[model samples]
Target: MGRRLRRAGRRAPAVAANADGRLEVFALAPGGSALHHRWQEAPGGAWAAAWQPFGTAAGGAPRVVRDGSGRLTVAAPAPSGVAVFHRRQTVPSGGWGEWQHLFGWSDAAPALAPSADGRLEAFALSPGGARLVHRWYADPAGTWAAAREFGEPGAPLAATPTAAADATGRIHVFAVTADGRIRTRVQERPSGGSGPWNAFGERLVAPLPAGTPAC
Candidate 1:
């Protein structure tokens, strides 16, 4: 069974269900300057009222995903473009860690997906949305590896990047190329490392005007 959940004021919500079946939704707060969250206590319970997750203002859409162990991690564009801030819920019972910074310059919101080995991988558009950048940690609590850009530098981005992990643990990133075609990059490793990016070369939609692209 399912129903449309409602919050009086939220935008670009990112949802993830915990191992115990509770649904957690993170969104840009009403003011559009902070992160707000709501969650289900059980399968059919009423959604909680929006509340700030970490008292931090968010500059872009928030992304949330659950790792293999059911821990929840969230990433959003910081009000400052110099970094992205993330918070992790270490336990299902609700002990969330303090917000941590991942330094990288992103002009668009970020995406998060759990790797096959239970770690988390993050993707975002570079400054001016002209490049795709990604990074991941060895584990939820481990050190983060270096950030790497995909595709050729200066390649124009037609939209914000989205990512997903298949059953086999391969991570795939999808985005609109400057020519209005869809493109993808695959991460060969299950632990969040990416392989070469591959483009579909087929125009999926009309190209947007440069500098005003949609994700």
Candidate 2:
């Protein structure tokens, strides 16, 4: 069953759930200048708050994730590069902290996920889209590690990259290759180092549709 739909702008929305179970949604405004966020106060509760605007002059769609403590961090394409922004609030509807820009650079959108250990990691395509680069917030708000590039010298990715962390503490990143197949790389927990880049060797999925944004 589906509820009757309401219309919005073209940019896709990103969502996250807090530890307390509040639902938060973020989307790019029609003009692409800022992000609009809305959230619920409780389970099955009526969505409260209007779409509040922040981060003027943003680019692409925003990516959001929650830390172990349920704080929110967002990354979106920006003029200089991708900018990571953070917003922290208490439960039962609380005031949000000031937005802070972290760091990143990519011609395409960035991806973010919390590792099994609860550290925040961000993945983005290089400025030229020739390489995949990443950085992590060891403390999720403290100093960030130096950027690292992964994958072999030649085979380039053809679309925006994505990442996920499983219960076993393994973080997997996936992308579509120029040859129209999918490739994956893993970074095991604790040590936080990646294994070899493995092309699935089979065409697991078709290439991204045309006009899809580059990863």
Candidate 3:
């Protein structure tokens, strides 16, 4: 599992998507290496992040998320690869339940995202390192959609991808390019006939300073 695994001095930032297809940034604990956060469309219909305790996987990557009705869903990833957690509807006891191994482990270290419509989508880089993929299943019992590529053929050489969802349910992904450049890409439903997936493109996510000192 390739977790965010930030380099010694580099802090891996949390990422999430917005309806405008924009990726938003969050503050990190000083000297902290990894970040885990959830993307939810707030009451006014804006993207907001719910950050999990730094370095704590107790309730899994995201301790909470927004359900379709905007109710908070607290779920956790289990060792058995199931998604399980306690919510207001959990049954008897203190709002907890048996662990459910939703999606088995991906060596790439999986990240969970709640889409605009409230469906949970998980993205992981191929264990063997070939493609960046996204898989979605409605609820715990929902069938998983086939894996979708999040980026072009090139691998994220230096930086890892942090995922996010927008108010419209579109997905935005951010990653550090091979040359240390920040790059972002998004997936969009075809605006017209379904000839092919011609609705995607890549652009500089965070452009580097335009001027530089001569070596």
Candidate 4:
């Protein structure tokens, strides 16, 4: 029942949704120029991106999460580093209020997820390659709290961390291991922190058929 986050950005475009039922898209421009992103109220809502150039050329991956009230939280890669973005306004027909930069730099791609009631909780690797960090905000600019870590760093983590939350707002995180094993971690709210990255499952990996990364 932990939160969920996905990888989005120029290198790997990602799409996320909140409990409020909105979707956000993340992508990159040509030649690593900028990180492009967008969000929609419904299926056909217009999408927008920060698209500013700056930070790690290689991305940590991007993801999005939504709260119960209809707010969306996005964890995306930027030139300066990995950060969090939140959706605050409602578009009359097919628009969204501007995305607000909520949380600052993260050591890795963020894991975002929404609670059953629309509250949002976000997670990411710490500034150093040590602890997994979690944070929650009532809205775009609400009080921010320091969340507990769910896992400890054992080996260098590769790939973007993916997260998911259940009906009760419990969170689960999975890491695609260097050796291709699926390592998983979990946590609970208010107290229970991250667990160890234990081998739990396997992903369906297939040989690439020679396709370029999506833009």
State every prediction's TM-score relative to the real structure. Answer: 0.82, 0.82, 0.44, 0.58
- Please give the TM-score that candidate 4 achieves against the real structure: 0.58
Q: Write candidate 4's Cα lDDT for 70-185 as tens digits.
A: 54444544445555454443532234565556556553456666544445666665444345566776554444566555554564344445677655556777654435455677
Ten contiguous residues with the weakest lDDT in model 3: 206-215
Give the C-alpha miss distance for residue 176 in model 3, angstroms: 2.2
TM-score of 2: 0.82
- Give the residue spans of candidate 3 off by over 4 A: 1-64, 69-94, 102-105, 127-130, 139-143, 157-160, 167-169, 189-215
Encode model 1's per-residue lDDT on 35-88: one tens digit a residue.
Answer: 667788677687765454554676766777787777888777777665677788
Give the best candidate by lDDT. Answer: 1
Stretches off by above 4 angstroms in model 2 are 1-9, 79-95, 209-215
Q: Tell me the tens digit of each residue's lDDT in model 3 across 71-108.
A: 33333333232323222214311122333444343332
Model 3, clash count? 15
Residue pairs in collision within model 1: none
Better of 3 and 4 by TM-score: 4
lDDT assessment of candidate 2: 0.66
Error of 2 at 208 (Å): 3.9
Q: Point out where model 1 deviates above 4 Å.
A: 1-10, 49-53, 207-215
State the C-alpha lDDT per candidate. Answer: 0.67, 0.66, 0.40, 0.49
